[model samples]
Target: MPQTDLSPISAAPGAAVLHDVLIIGGGLVGASLAIALDRLGLEVGLVEATAPGALPAVFDERNLSFAEATVNALTALGVMQKLRAPTGAIERIHVSRAGDFGRSVLEAAKYGRSEFGRIVVARDFGEALEARLAELARLRRYRPMRFLGLADGGSDTRAVRVADVDGERVLHTRLLVAADGTRSGVREALGIGVDEHDYAQTLFVTRLRSERAPDGTAYERFGADGPTALLPRGDRSFGLVHGVARAEADAVAALDEAAFLARVQTAFGWRVGRFLGCGPRSAYALTRVLAQALTAPRAVLVGNAAQTIHPIGAQGFNLGLRDALTLAELIENARRETNGAGFDCGDTAVLAQYAARRREDRGRTVAFSDGLARFTANELPLLRPLRSLGLFAADRLPSAQAYLVGAAMGYRGDVPALCRGGTQPGALA
Candidate 1:
């Protein structure tokens, strides 16, 4: 995390921007990847369509959950300490079904951890990423630019066609990374098809002010409409994500604050007390997008561009950060091999290694998120009793609680070095 003087724009106007690696997107994942590479003294270029700080979609507004492991990784990478916003800790999790007979509680202490995770607004996180990106002297940023085309593939040196403020430009690099969000242009240019599933659900997000303050606790209540989550925020307000059918989203959004609070109270009960006030509401259609492959020759995908899953487990962004960290570690080593002779950061070996190592983690996270979304929303009576039994078991049984707690904390199989409280290629930094 040591700072260095940023390398000047290595690529000239109307000429190829030459670098060790070129990132096609500069969102959270993409920007962090650039910073991680800069820490290793790699010449990196970030191509972003939007100017810094003014991001759209999930980049702002909503309160986001950062798995304990994810926060540790970002902190180790010098990304978290720079954030300016206040954050809350999730010391415990309460899970139950509306009007169900049983409930489950997962405590961080049960797993020998101080807290399960931390919560912060997307706006604050966006600001942190920008701050880090600005300090990366090794990174050359190309903003207000886009991936206009892909050229020089199937060649020794691959070049990406980009359109930016300098007009038509070309970026030649050993690798092209597609951190370009779900509608990824690089993914499309690579002809990489994605398996997408529309959950037919829309999530309404807002800040809730309850009469009784949350005590470092988070709740997930599953009802007929969908799953509702009340996450503890730093300001003592609860961040709420209420899922409803697509057809009902508009009607729900049109409801006034009082009516909306009433609906939430009815679904969640008095567990968290009365909903007093709430901020403006926003809604998002839920869908899962997984690319058929994680990498292609001279190109790779990371973050949301690789997989966009249901937000139930808070795994989407956490998993994406892993993708970035994992890729950075692999690339850092690749640069040292051969004593830097004809070193290729985009070598097939690196891509293959990344794809192999990420396969299990990606599969597990996607399955966990998708399964939670489907099962909790299923209205079948036969599943109700089973769900109740499962929740109660998690609450009562140590092994059951451990399993859920481990996953939520990002402590699953083959955890990345940073997540494990260790560093990979640490000597380089």
Candidate 2:
């Protein structure tokens, strides 16, 4: 992928930069929004706390599961074509609960698709997004910048104060977007609170070398401890996200490679063969963070800022990408209605429309992830039989299987223009 050093700029303190949209936290989602808006004739500015050659810790060694729809959206945005590294396709998913007699399998071929989705390492995806963002003609990139707070910009404009390497300046815009993660500053500054849930579990993740090359299959094994997922990655290895009791996480991390591999093998069984070796591991306490509202006065949240769910089903980023594309479409269509003259980028009516359309999709996604995570963790003996029966029915019944496959492939919920492969108004002319 092509890499560009952020065009150097030194805006003086208190000097104003006018824009139609100002996006805070220029990670993948923020950058994607900037790219979308810039193409739609909006002057955009991205404020990032990290410097150019380095990114926030969330973009560290991690694998991101991209739904088929997200891949289509990336392709439409011309970002997928710029990737230097290839992705691993998830052609099939095998799911089962530990100590259960039944298991379920979802195959992409049954749905007339070659793959359910693809997996890309966090670093690779970020590189592609950053490269694409650099190519934006109407985007002003600001790095090593800290958002001070929202300032009173009077009517007709939203003002954000930010400090960069040079000095502090106020960014004026008609619309403000927060793509920042869980503890979003923009969300907090706007006084938008979140309803939080702790799963009481922690996830230990790393890349693993297997005795045999992965055959385009991903495994989700639920156990007494928690769910363990192995996503196929390149180099004949699998990306492991092993969930364990929060209290036991440190001990697991302290295990020697031999012992660590043995524990995982014992929990997951020897389906895909033994895990030979693994790279360095990291752990995070699992939690679900959801903002009370999706929009504020002249401001709104996207990506994790809007909702953060457990990673059990890999719905986090995929849903966020949908948020980005939906907002873009709403803006594109609204602009056309006004003949490019009287469109208010952050009008209450426009924000309300975006929020109203998002309710069902966001609600269902979070509910599904939370429900699955909790259900798999349930260890009651009586419920085990029922859960097993459900799994078996889902596997054998075509209708049940189709519903499961639809959710897994992200064909459920609202479909966006980018995912449909239709020409977008924001596509470069």
Candidate 3:
């Protein structure tokens, strides 16, 4: 992403730069939204806190599981074609619980899919986003800028105060978006409260090479402590997410490479061959953060600022991308309806429609992630039989398998047009 180095003229009291839509964050979701709106004939501005040539913490070494719908949306936005790194295909998923007799398997071939989705390293995806953003014809990027707070504005627009290297200035916009992480300043400025839940678990992510290269099958094994997942990667290694009790996380992290591999092998069993080499592990505390409302006045929330869910089902970024695409679709429709005569992007009806369209998808995704995280953590003996039976039913019954497949592929309510299979960039249908 190329950022302008010229110092911007400080706006006088009544003179301010205005945008059709101003996004507060430039992370994964925010950047995606900026790219979507770029093709829609809107004057867009992106506030990125990170300076040029430096990657944000969100683009760490962790691996991201993209649902099929997410893959389609990114491809449609021309982001996937810019990726420098190859992605791993998930052709099959195997799910089971420790000390249980039942197991479930989902195959993409059975559902007429070449693969459920592709897995990309977060760092690689971030680089792809930058490449795509650089190609946008009309996106204004404010790098190394900090959003101060909401400023005074008329009823039709919102005034946002921000500080850059030069100085502080106010920018006006018809729509304000909060794509910042779990703790969002824009949401706070809008007086939108959040509901939080701590899972009391620490997730460790890393990569491991086995005697056998991954055959495009992902494994999810749940134990009393937590769930351990291994996702296939393009480099002939498996991306690992291991969950452990918060109290025991440090000890697990301090283990020697051999010891760590052994523990994972014991927990996950020898589905693949023995682990040969392991990479450095990174730990993150698991928590679910949900905004009380999706919109307030002329502003709205997307990505983690809207809802941060457990990573058990690998639904965090996939759901957030859906949020971004849905909003972009709605804004595109509004612009077309007015024949480019300049309609209100922040009109109450537009925000209400966006909120209503997102409710079912967001609520169901949160419930699935949160419920799975809690359900697998409980080891009550009385629930053991129920768990086994549920797994059996899910594996045997067609309806249950179909539901799981739908969730896995992100075919939820009100999917955006660009999220459909084979959608081209800038397509309306």
Q: Give the Cα lDDT of each candidate.
A: 0.82, 0.83, 0.87
Q: Which residue pairs in model 2 clash with each other?
A: none
lDDT tens per residue, model 3, 54-102: 7778998798999999898898889999989888999998999998779
Q: How does candidate 1 fare on TM-score? A: 0.94
Q: After superposition, how far is residue 364 of candidate 1 from its true place, in Å?
A: 0.8
RMSD to the hidden true structure, all candidates: 2.4, 2.1, 2.1
Residue runs of model 2 more than 4 Å from their true location after superposition: 1-9, 427-429
Residue 161, candidate 1: Cα error in Å is: 1.7
Q: What is the TM-score (0 to 1) of candidate 3?
A: 0.96
Comparison by lDDT, 1 against 3, better one: 3
Which candidate do you rate higher for TM-score, 1 or 3? Answer: 3
lDDT of 3: 0.87
Which is better, 1 or 2, measured by TM-score?
A: 2
The candidate 3 region of ten consecutive residues with least summed lDDT is: 3-12
Q: List runs of model 1 lying over 4 Å from the truth.
A: 1-11, 424-429
Candidate 2, residues 129-165, lDDT tens digits: the string is 8777767676777787899888998888898887866
Worst 10 residues of 1 by lDDT: 4-13
Q: Among these predicted structures, which one has the highest lDDT? A: 3
